[model samples]
Target: MWRELAAIGRETSTGGYRRYAWTAADTDCRSWFRDQAGARGLSHETDRNGNQWAWLGDPAAGDAVVTGSHLDSVPDGGAFDGPLGVVSAFAALDELRSRGAEFTRPLGIVNFGDEEGARFGLACVGSRLTSGQLTREKAYALTDADGITLPGAMEAAGHDPGAIGPDPGRLARIGAFVELHVEQGRALDLSGDRVGIASAIWPHGRWRFDFRGEANHAGTTRLADRRDPMPAYAETVLAARRAAELAGAVATFGKIAVEPNGVNAIPSLVRAWLDSRAADRATLDTVVAEIERAARDRARSDGVDLSVVRESFTPVVEFGHALRDELNRLLGGRVPVLATGAGHDAGILSAAVPTAMLFVRNPTGVSHSPAEFAAEDDCAAGVLALADVLEGLACR
Candidate 1:
């Protein structure tokens, strides 16, 4: 499994992996999934929104037990974030077969697209659309850093953008969703546990800031006369930090681009993106509002035009209590229940169906980069936990 993931990693130039949706790397990973599912004799189909589902039984079976996750990765993202869930789902099936476990209800392994939103600027694109959590028009208009609209990219990738929308009928087939993901934070490590059940996902959202000013020669432009955007941009970043700190949440100004970026040119515009998250909706809203106010104030004082647009917003999600209890019971012990700040396909799907998550320990307590890790033993433990849960759920 590591070898397969490493192959995908090798195809990327940004350190770890960059399998953005509809990109060559993502397409290759999709093919890899098809090959794996075929080898297992599972019938496979791609939904209208491009989600891939491989089934072990009849498709018409109502409420099929489903497990899996996304395959796309952030730029230079670690090997485990998305792929571990997929690899573990396949491995769990193998483990079940080895143990001769039988099921009454159908079982499905799915590969949700664009969970990272690295290309389209909207996370959980497949799951959210399929679950009716996101609208078609909003999704189609989303653009990447290169300014290519999502619809154009979808067309380029041979998927009809017009087909994207709420898929309640398709989602009705899933009785429950259980996603296995590498723990992206220190919670599991602090608890000293190999496996955990997710209780909730912290509220989170993304915003884009565009600051416009006059471009001028760096050497000739007098400091007093210059209407440079960099100062306003810098103030906005600082405001974000201060606001997040005051609100007791987290905020990041990670992506920035300066127009006329030449060393000898004063930038005419500065564009930055902010990712903000908090334990509750109120805090998240407060932090975002504060940052936006600060940005506008700075822009006005600096004679720079400003625009702030919300890219995506996912409220704090509480996993199905019944499903979580079942998973805990299957483990035969008090599996710690934890909440994550990270957004996931499971979080999006929870709006449509009973959804839960199992997190494998990340020794590094890190994700979205090459340094993320899960031990071989921990990986195997995750499969066992998944198998146990699947057996219990499928038998119901």
Candidate 2:
């Protein structure tokens, strides 16, 4: 499975995946998912929100046990972040069948769309839409860097934008949803464990800062006489680092755009996006406020007009105790439980459904980059653990 998926959306230079939403690479990944479902003899279907589902039993049957994850990637992302869960899902099903497990309830595997939000800037769009966290009107207004609206992209990718909205009926049918993913951090590795359960997701958000200033010739403009947004933007980046250090949080300005980008010209605008996260809501809020205040102060001193807009936010998600306890029992009460700063589709669906996540050990704790990886034995352990959970949940 990995061999076939490794080639799709991969960049030759970086050896990373670029499977952005609704793009050709994303299309290829979707096709690969459909083919996998067919090979498994599972009933394949696409939900109104473009989430792919493969069912071993009747979907209309209530109290279905579903397990799977997304197949998209961040910009130049590593191989295991999303695809590991999906491949593990299929492998788990195979393991269950080999064990002669008999399902008393319906079983399902899903491949959620636009999970990374590399194109639309909103993570978990597929699950959020189905759970009614994101409104259709707002989703329609999402535009990419190329000035293409989300609706246009959906239409071009052969999905109906008008059909997208809250999918209460579908979500209501699911009794439990479990997503198995490669760990984004080193919790499992540090503990000498191959698999662990997620307890909570940190409060996280993305904010955009727009700094407007005058455009001039870089060589001719005197430093003391000019209003440059770059200086303020640079200072804000440093401030983010300092504030995060003080607050015990994490913040990064990973993406940016400059107006009239040229080496010989002073940029008129500096648009940067900040991604910040903390273990709790209050800490995250305080950290972001401090960063914004620093940016404003620097902008004023530099004579630059500044505006900040929050693009997306997800509050801390505490997985339900009942299901988590059940999983612990199913896994023999030995697996470690850890909290994560990263967000997942499981986090988005936990509000509407009984959702939980399992993390596979990552040796280096690196993610969202080409260097992200998991040991082969650890991956095998993950598949076996998922198979055991599904058997415990559905077979009995």
Model 1 quality (TM-score): 0.97
Model 1 alpha-carbon miss at residue 191, Å: 1.4
Write model 2 residue lDDT over 154-191, tens digit each, in one string. Answer: 99999988899999999888999999999999988899
Per residue, candidate 1 scores C-alpha lDDT tens digits across 255-301 of 88898998999899899999999999999999999999998988898
Off by over 4 Å in 1: 9-14
Model 2 — TM-score against the truth? 0.99
Highest-TM-score candidate:
2
Candidate 1: residue 259 Cα off by (Å):
0.8
The true-versus-predicted C-alpha distance at residue 354 of model 1, in Å, is 0.2
Give each model's whole-structure lDDT. 0.89, 0.95
* Backbone clashes counted, model 2: 0
- Listing every candidate in turn, what is its Cα RMSD in Å to the true structure after a full C-alpha superposition? 1.4, 0.7
List the lowest-lDDT window of 10 residues for candidate 1.
Answer: 6-15
